[model samples]
Target: MEQSDFYELNDGAKLPAIGLGTVNIQGAKGVNSVLTAIDAGYRLIDTSTNYMNEGMVGEAIRRSTVPREELIISSKLPGAAHDYDKAITMIQESLYRLGIDYFDKYLIHWPLPMQGKYVEAWQALIDAQKFGLIKTIGVSNFLEEHLEKIIDKTGVTPATNQIERHPYFNNNEVVETNKKLGILTEAWSPFGREINDVIEHETIAKIAKKYDKTPTQVIIRWNLQNDVMPIVKSSSLKHQKANLNVFNFELTQEDIQTIDLLDKGEPGRVEGQHPNEYEEFG
Candidate 1:
């Protein structure tokens, strides 16, 4: 995207359509990986307390030739820090670790609805935004109820909802819900994380062959075409560049439908945890 791409969030903030995900990337290698993404034209970079690499992400920001204001940096609050006081501290701590003044966006990593603290956490995020600690605030892994709970209690809708989405599990229900709410849906594991199960699918392979592109490119494009921002992770520079090169081709509506048809519902979830029951201790 030479002109670069952006999406107008519900909160009237602009966010890049495609972003780099820093999951396993850590330490010096992680720093280099994030730097590579910045150098490769990724304007948005996603990090999280759960990911445990805010320091490296911060270092990459320092080393990048791109101006700090030009890049949109995001991080998340951990499950352990859902309390009002703890959530506020974690937001400040993330900034301290990143050595940045403020985050472009920040999210609650999980709803942890069972604890009934997510709404309370949402209140903390609102306070942080008012304090100018973060430009935008949202949540991850939130189902419909989780989303409504916060919005009902606080009257603040999240700007985005990051979730596990791929061909194997389209999660269209959540996607459409986000759509109606005017919330941008971000796909975390756009490639299914397990890799082979998604990219190697017969349907995706056929479309890839038709476009003369790898299944990876097709997936990223699929996310864009579906109005979903994809946060993809790649350690190699070549793959990072290749991931963003998807703009040249367009998938036919029929192809998009066929791909969506490949959804296996809950059976296709790659990550073992369901958002509702997941109790994150780490």
Candidate 2:
């Protein structure tokens, strides 16, 4: 990763502009993929307890040539462990699973507002950070209301907010809100999963051609240019390499404007789970 491709969080921690999102890949395959990405110059790895791959990620880190301190490893607290006590225990369990003493970053996987425990969970995260178990703390799938509630209650703002953001569903309002709060916006599913049309979109293709890059590369560059850190997942070494190769070129202002117009608002949300209504817990 280039020195220019990193964002400084509110806590003064630096995060890679692009991270490997370990969602479905598991076991030896996941380990190898992660190792390959690290070898290919990826310094950030994003995983979660819900993803059930922290163990694999840990194994990969152990086997890789990269030192643990050089990599930014992040995990999330699952909705199943929303209470303060459960959140603390779950983070410890995740640390044990990852074979690490401390995480560079930890996040609440989702607000699950209907459960009404995210504020308490946030407090647990704050305590964990104070305990030296986590270096930086943040949240995922949290909206403006969720962010405000937690900050208002604890007087501690999250270091980052990970949310589903792609060209089709940029969620500009949330991104702006995070910016105003000094919270870095980390984009999950930055490529608009299963939406082949985005990769094949005329505007993206045109921009890619102009920059002599792939459409995916164009989109990733767009995220960086917009000050959004994107977590992109790919099991294939080829795709992973391609994803990391995006920093070489710059996206034109007009091209970015064209992609911006692709936003479809609510209908463009790929995950289909609203933060306010998603209350599932184990």
RMSD of each: 1.2, 1.3
Show model 1 residue runs off by greater than 4 Å: 1-3
Clash number for candidate 2: 0
- Model 1 clash count equals 0
lDDT of 2: 0.90
**Candidate 2 local lDDT, 1-282, one digit each (tens):** 353557889999999878889999899999999999998888989999988899999999999998899999999999889889999999999999999999999999999877789999999999999999999999998899999999999999999999888999988899999999999999988888877588888888988998899999998888888899889999888999899888678877888899999999888887556677766655
My TM-score estimates for the predictions, one after another, are: 0.97, 0.97
Candidate 1 lDDT over residue span 148-195, tens digit each: 888999999999999989998889999999999989999989988865
Query: Going through the candidates in order, what is the number of backbone clashes in each?
Result: 0, 0
Clashing pairs in 1: none
Candidate 1 TM-score over all chains jointly? 0.97
TM-score of 2: 0.97
